[model samples]
Target: MRRAVIALVITAAGLVPLLRYHPNTTTTAIRATAGTAQTPSASSKAPSTSGTRTVTGSEVDTEFGPYQVQVTFNGSTITDVQIVEAPSDRRSQRIAESAAPTLRQEALRAQSAKIDTVSGATITSEAYAQSMQAAIDAS
Candidate 1:
């Protein structure tokens, strides 16, 4: 009985830290802009001099952090996709760093945001796709 009681106490103690641990759940208030030139208004869409247009997507709030992207379009063709914002936390940073290239490649290949999510970075991938789609739509 005494051993069972001690084991129970230890288990409870182990669970205490798990219960106390809280991740960053607060959402940021960053907004996205659509334009090659920096503009104050979110609705403004400016075309670059080289006949390409860069459009920034709306910021997507995820459990990790805000995700956003900027897409450059040459007429109707997507020329580039750039991550404008992402989670800065160490774990998230690692995941983003590894996943970004694959995601970019997929987006470029698909010519849209309908790309598969990275295996371990589901949340970030979803957020990235949403932001990328928004940018594509804006452009």
Candidate 2:
């Protein structure tokens, strides 16, 4: 009984902080949805930088590795987004292959850092969103 209680205490101690953590939301709604690969078309171009400013997000560490993003904006509107850093692990590579395009598309469509979380890539998605928020804040 004592050992079981001790184990439970240890588990709770570790998980509580994670549960209480919250990243500042940069946009309105972040719908949790299925992750899909939606690569931008070759002809698709982000907004021109002629009248925009660029800002890079802070590096956000996740369970897998570090992640970051750069955002270009024309005044208050987000013009384009670029992934500046992310994990290169094999599993992360496979997940990013699919998740990256989807995330980018979503960001463009929404025009903000706030994005729907990818179902299978929760950690990466959260980190991505947070980093996006950081960039916007800096911009």
Candidate 3:
């Protein structure tokens, strides 16, 4: 019984530190993903010509629901996107905001949905891709 009690105490002591040591995994992942997601590839060169264009598209049956996106294209490149509608939940909203940079970067790079999804935000990433596709189609 004494040996068992000592073992229990040691185990509990080990776990105390483990529990108290906060890794902040979520923040770390978000930061890493945010960093990788924004870097532009070499292929996404800016258009050489000067002209303004616009495109609009909508995505349905996403994890969130239907969303509409409008993109402004200059020459052959996508310049900006206007979010007409987004998911209703707070988490989804946050995800939507976070995903914008990733989506825009991809659009600048490959000009399509071929870009990678943001880590830990799969559903939100899909939503962003769909919306971006709509914008590309419109353009």
Top-lDDT candidate index: 1
| Model 3 pairs in collision | none
Runs of candidate 2 with Cα error greater than 4 angstroms are 1-50
- Candidate 2 residue-pair clash tally: 0
lDDT per residue (tens digit) for residues 2-53 in model 3: 9999999999999999899745223211111112122222332343334675
TM-score of every model versus the real structure = 0.70, 0.60, 0.55
In terms of TM-score, the best-performing candidate is 1
Q: In candidate 2, how many Å is residue 111 off? A: 2.0
> How high is the CA lDDT of each candidate model?
0.76, 0.70, 0.58
Candidate 3 C-alpha error for residue 79, in Å? 1.5
TM-score of candidate 2 on Cα atoms, chains taken together:
0.60
For model 3 the local lDDT of residue 11 reads 99
Higher-scoring candidate on TM-score, 1 or 3: 1
Q: For candidate 3, what is the lDDT?
A: 0.58
Model 1: which residue pairs collide?
none
